[model samples]
Target: MKIHEICFSPTGGTKRVSSMLSRALTDETVEVDLTAREVDFGQVELSPEEVALIAVPSYSGRVPTVAAARLAAMHGNGARAVLLCVYGNRAYEDTLVELRDKASGAGFKVIAAVAAVAEHSIARQYAAGRPDAEDEAMLRSFAARIRRKIDDGGLDEPVIPGNRPYRKAAGAGIVPKATRACVKCGLCAAKCPVGAIDAKEPARVDKKRCISCMRCVAVCPHHARRVNRLLLALVGRMLKKACSQRKACELYL
Candidate 1:
C-alpha cells in the first residue's frame, strides 16, 4: 500500500504538520500540492489499497473555500484517508468534521482524524514557532498508533469533533494588497493558488476571488503585499484573548 500526502497550506504551517505525519508513517510517500494553481486534483487517482493524508488549514473555523473546491475534485477510489485540520491556535471548530465528510464524499474511507495547532497565518503572535519540539513528539506518537491500527487491518471510522452544516464563515474583511514597495515582479500572480491576482498587472486583486489565505504576503520577497495595519491590529485585539492560551494537538483514532 502506498501513502499520499495531499496538503493545502497557504502559509506553510499546514504543510509542516502534514509532512511530519507523512514522514513518520513511511519513507515512501507522494505529495499532492493543493496550492498549485495549474494542477487539477481530479487527475490524481488513488487505488483502494492506498492511504491518503488529507491536510488543510482551517480558515475562519472552516476549510478554505478554494481548498475545498480543489479537494472535491480529487478521486480517492476507496483509499483510506487520515484527515487533519491545522488551525492557528484558536479553534478548528467544524474544520475537522467537515474535512472528514468531504474526504468520505470524495470516495476515501475515513480511518482517523486530527486537529493540530499552528502559528496563525495572519496573526504571527499566536501559536508562534509551533509544531515545535512538543508538537513533533505528539505527531510521532500519533503516527505510531496509526501504523499499528493499519497493520491490524482495522478500518473502523474515527468519530471526530465538529458540527454538521458548519458555522457560517464570517471572514475578517482584511484583504492584502501590494504596497508602493511592490516591484511588480508578478510572482504573487504566478503563484496565487486561485489565480486571483492578474499576472500581467500584479497590482490589481480580484477581491471576490481572494480567500485571504495570505500566500501572497508570505511569498513576497520585497515584503510589499500586506493587509491594512489598522485592520490587522483590530484582528489581533479580537483574537488575543482566545489565542493567548496554548492548545494541544488532539487525535481521534
Candidate 2:
C-alpha cells in the first residue's frame, strides 16, 4: 500500500522519529512537511488506497496549533492512518488522542498509534542521542507487526491516549533571543515556520509569531540563541521525573 508520512518538526527531533518509522514501514513514502513556511493547507489531499502515517511532535502535550489546523484542512479520502506522537523524552499526555481525533475527523480510519521519544527539544541534555539504534530496531519490529495486521485485515479497535475533552493548549513561553555571539546570520529567520525572526537583524524576534519550538536555539551555529533560562529551568524541574526515566518507544497496532 502507498504510505503518506506527514510530520511537523520544528527542531528535527520529530522529523527524525517520523523518518525512522516510515523507513521501517515501507520504502514508498510521501512526506507532508507541515513546517514549510509557504504551506497551503488546501493543497494536501490523500487517497483511500493509501495508508497515512501521520506524525507530529508533542508541543506541551498537544499538537502544534498550526499543524493541527493544516491537518484539519486536508481530505483524507478514507485512508487508514497510523497516528504517531513523538515527544522529547517527556510525557506525550494528550497528543496521541488529539491526533487520532484530528485524523479521524479528516475522514481517515485510525488503525494504529505510537508514542515515541527523541531528544528533548528545549534541553538537549535530557534524552540526548535518542532514536538511536535501539529505538530504530524497536520501531522496525513495530512496523512489521502493523504490516501483518494490515495484510490480514485484522485491525482491532484503536486505543488512543488522552481523555475525551483533550487538555487545552499551553501558553506560549518566553521567546528565544540572540546573544552577543550571534554573527548577524539569518538562518533562524529563514527557517522559522512563522517568520518570527527578522532576517536583516537576526537578534530581533517577534514574540507573537514565535511558537517556542526551540528551532532557533538548535540551529544557531554560534550557540548564540537562548530562551529564558529561568523558564527553562522551571520546566525542566517540573518534568524532571518523566524526563529522567528512559521510556521505551511504543507502537499500538
Best by lDDT: 1
Off by over 4 Å in 2: 154-157
TM-score of each: 0.97, 0.93
Candidate 1 ranges with C-alpha deviation above 4 Å: none
Kindly report the root-mean-square deviation of model 2 from the true structure over all alpha carbons: 1.7
lDDT of 1 by residue, 1-253 (tens): 4689999998899999999988888898899999998896889889888999999999988988878888889899899999989999998899988898889888898899988999999888999999898999999999999988887878999888889889998753667988999988998988888888988877888887888889999999999999889888998999999999999998999
* Whole-structure CA lDDT of model 1: 0.90
Relative to the unseen true structure, what is the C-alpha lDDT of residue 35 in candidate 2, on a scale of 0 to 100?
80
Residue 79 in model 1: shift from native, Å?
Answer: 0.3
